[model samples]
Target: MTKPGAVSSAQLSRRSLLRRSALFGGAALLGPAVLSACGDDDAGATAAAASGTKVSTVFSWVKNVEWAGFWVGDDQGYYTDEGIAPDWIGGGPNAPENVQVLEAGKAGIGLASDTLKIIDAAAQGADFVMFAATLQESPVGFAWLDPNIKSIHDLVGKTLGGDSSSPSMIDACFKVNGIANDYNFIQIGADPAPLANGQVDAILCYTTNQVSVLEAQGLTVFSATLTEFGVPLYADALIAKRSFLDANHEAVVRFLRATIKGHEKNIQDPELGARLATEKYGVDLALDYDGQLTENRKQIELWVSDVTRKKGVLWMDKDYIAGPVYEGIRAAGRTELPDVNKLVDLSFLTEAYDGKTTLLSA
Candidate 1:
């Protein structure tokens, strides 16, 4: 998922259009490497025929614990074992949207914030299909430094700060608990400073990102995730164009296999993943090592759940896609929900693990 200040979808779409034009114009002058025709599949074939294929993946945000698997996989030569040289693209406020980049053929695979975005993009004829879910549950939640606001029920009469869209999830939670809406929703950015300074009782932010920052600033922050309150939404999924998946089936499988192995390694030893992300992949980001380590551990906890514990990391359970994920989208007022079959393709993940759930032993 994107950090607080990341650009919006509209902004990303415009930037991508410009980038596509520039790339196409440069292709005639620079040759095939600058052309979209040299997609991941062709790259893989070239790798087989020559050295190794280099594939690029556009992440949703800047390098941090959220991308531990990719970093660890690259560091451990997991992608190399698959005959794939990975180009890890860092994203932030200026990076184009993942789906836009994939559709433009700038990147082979991309990570999106949620399936809903992919569904919406597909409706607009993007042809993006999700292959693996990175985080089982979204980390979006309401956080506060006040100890009295322990649960969702306690925020009934308080003022909460967040984007206007955040109310959909909050409303879904209130509906599930049969509680009447009494709290005042104030529109704000993804900053917890207002809550820290007593401007708002709580603020909606990603638990994995902001909670640690709040705690480190000398506040006892308490949080309640949307999933805990009956919104079972998945976050951060790997997606590629349908045409790309159709052409590079084996390449996709190999990529996911290496990726899953990387996640397993992260689960087994989060410190290693943290070190790789901070000291290696994210060296230029000036990330805090201790803060990143804390977030990495929290992210690993989110990656596993009752479903993943048995079905393996990145497992796309049909029941989940059809049930809670669907309901959460509807609750959020998104009506153009794509068909579950069209939205996700789990064949690669299933083949990666041979249809067996694999979990790291504690």
Candidate 2:
């Protein structure tokens, strides 16, 4: 007898509607023509010539509600006003990874979320530095059905399913709680079938993503954000190569200024982005309006924090990174920890807001 809210194998296909594969470092490289700029070409070119430089921003995911701010920014002419004709290249499961795009000089800015990967690339002499983050804290976490699995510690002797990055994050979580790092982990991609049918106990997921999919399919899923599990990472991280930063510092600041305004717009009208993504930006993907709206609302909660209220939007705290973030990765068996200062630069965001928390007009 299946318990209430338990998902069966027959219901697995329901999740495919919102299933998004995690972006890896070695995905196929895509060309510039894949996704055009969200901004007007003629006007943006003129503005680029007058004040800002043209930049390419390679997104880490599909052009769904995840990129609502960028879409809003383009629609509002924020990028053109800042003199940037941004080519908003969208990424998907088969798209080029941000690291390769940036390293190959294909993009000036890239959205990367994995802190460990950024550090690893830096160790290999990639010369990348994170400037701003869309979400103040990571939304990635574990989703489970067992009522017994209340806290992260409860998964002590259970089989967990996740993508490629789950093991290190779990190791980090265990280390922080002073729990013995002992558990079974398997790469199960993004499906919740194994978990629903009892092949695995839990699966790593994003709060706004897979969890939402499960709930939409009549499954009541309990989840804990990555911060609660001791791995507090900044998601939707905006990164660029050091040389690009050196050459186009002001352009980068201008881009962030415009992007922050777009994010502010998203906060005011969550459904606006969902509509934009569904009707226009991601129209070909056949995204569900209601699902995107739910994801946007959930993401808004992750975007703001006490730090953002004081330091301004997209603020990256060095101390926070040095403490919990680095500790988590290092505890996960990583040997070298990159210097936080070298890995991040908050000055770009500082210049964008001029020491204020918002650019929205009152």
Candidate 3:
């Protein structure tokens, strides 16, 4: 029987195109009418000025509840209020990497999925800086249909399905649980069909995403979140190239101000954010409204935490950033870590809120 949070590769692969379409569809959103007319010699400079200082942000993933705040900000004209025209670029398999997009001057800021990627980029001489983390904890986890598999320790000899990124998380789980590496890993995409069909014992995926898909399929799923398993990784950080930040500090601050406000609004009414994302910005992406709503609520749970409760959403303290967050990356086999001081600049977030902490509600 298909368990809750279990999906076949066929189901996920089919929906995968919907996500990719949003990435490619971003071009349609950035047509001439939206972008300001400019000469080739100073395209970036003129584009920034033409539309009241255009600021393009490339997301790490396609449009979904993960970007509910950006959609809410756009719909509510928060970006306009900040005196900037924001272009939100979606990411997918076919989309260029977030750092590459930023390096090419396509985006002023990018939403990166993990600190590892940022660290790697910095090591490779990319002048990128993480200004804020949207998700306090990562949603990466292992989802299993078998009741026997209640924890990461239970999957000693079971087949774990996931993509290239899955192994590091699995290794982290073993290390955290003080268990040996005995689990067999099968290369799989985001699809949980293999697991559902008994092809694989379990699948590694985002708890906020595949969990809802499996539950919708009426399966009983048990998920082991990596965060609880000894890998407390942060997800979805706001990043920008150093050059971009240096030239447009005010624009960055303004952009974050509107984005945080949007997140605040989304926290108040997730259904509204979901509706706006699916019916408006993601209208052409063929999104499932009910599913998106479920994901939106789950995503909010990841965004707010004890830290965010005290300092507001997207807040990160130096101790946590340099400690557990960095250690998680190291556990994943990354050795050349970026300097914490050079990697994160909290001044933008500080400036956005005027040094005052806004408590998260709900």
Candidate 4:
């Protein structure tokens, strides 16, 4: 007989949902014919334009919601106003990884999942520097079929899904709640469908994505949250090369500033956001545009609050990062943590909310 706490197959179902946003990046909404932009312009140039120099932004995997804010900025001419003319490129399995591109000078901004990667990158002698965090609450959660599997204790012996990036949070949630880490965790590369297929019991997911996509399929996913249980981590940071920051410091700052406003819009407007997401921004709408858009908007709501605003829109809690984050990652068996200060650059966020940019009403 199955234990009372153990989730049953009946609990997880074909018509279930999971948490939304997580590791997977977004895709562009519309193709070039459907949407158009001034491709080459020195819009983000802070000091001087290098005679028609064009910079490229490598967004992760087509278009996920992580890059929506920047897309909003571009669509609204925010980047043009900032003197930066950027061609936002789609990233995927074939696209260069952020660290590599930044190192090779391929892309200007590097977007990725989890701050843990930040420490690893810096330690590897990678030139990436974290600018701002996209996910305020790390976007880590488990999606099960059964509401009975609400608590961590309920996850025992149940099959979970995710990559190494989120296992710590998953394990932390289980550990803090007194659940065993011995539960089934299938190694899912990037797709959340396996969970929908009922191949695994539940899977780690992001609130702005998998859940929404699954739900859109008329499947009901029971999203289990790590923060609600016990553990927490940072997700989706806006990163850039150290040299890029140094060379185009003002531009980078402006980019961040514009992004905040863009995120603000990204949250407020879903259709326009989704339409723009498809047309300009590269968010993978693959049969789930509304779902993806809905989730992205939800993320904006969960995080973009005054609590995060330190005189402006900043996604960092200083004491928490300096204290909990460091200790937490170390406890997770990471070699070391990145300097909390280095991981967070509040200057741009400060300046934007503090009225630094005179152009876009920042």
What would the TM-scores of all predictions be?
A: 0.78, 0.85, 0.83, 0.76
| Tens-place lDDT digits, model 2, residues 145-233 | 77777787888988998767678677777887778877999876566667665778988766666767666667767888778777678
lDDT of every model, 2 decimals: 0.65, 0.71, 0.68, 0.56
TM-score of candidate 2 on Cα atoms, chains taken together: 0.85
- In model 1, how large is the Cα lDDT of residue 67? 79
Q: Is candidate 1 or candidate 2 better by TM-score?
A: 2
Largest TM-score belongs to which candidate? 2
Q: How do all the candidates rank in terms of TM-score, highest first?
A: 2, 3, 1, 4
Better structure of 3 and 4 per TM-score? 3
* Model 4 weakest lDDT span, ten residues long: 28-37
- Pairs clashing within candidate 3: 3-219, 4-219, 4-220, 5-214, 5-215, 7-192, 7-193, 8-193, 9-193, 48-53
Residue pairs whose backbone atoms clash in candidate 1:
none
Candidate ranking under lDDT, highest first, comes to 2, 3, 1, 4
Model 2, which residues run further than 4 Å from truth? Answer: 1-10, 14-52
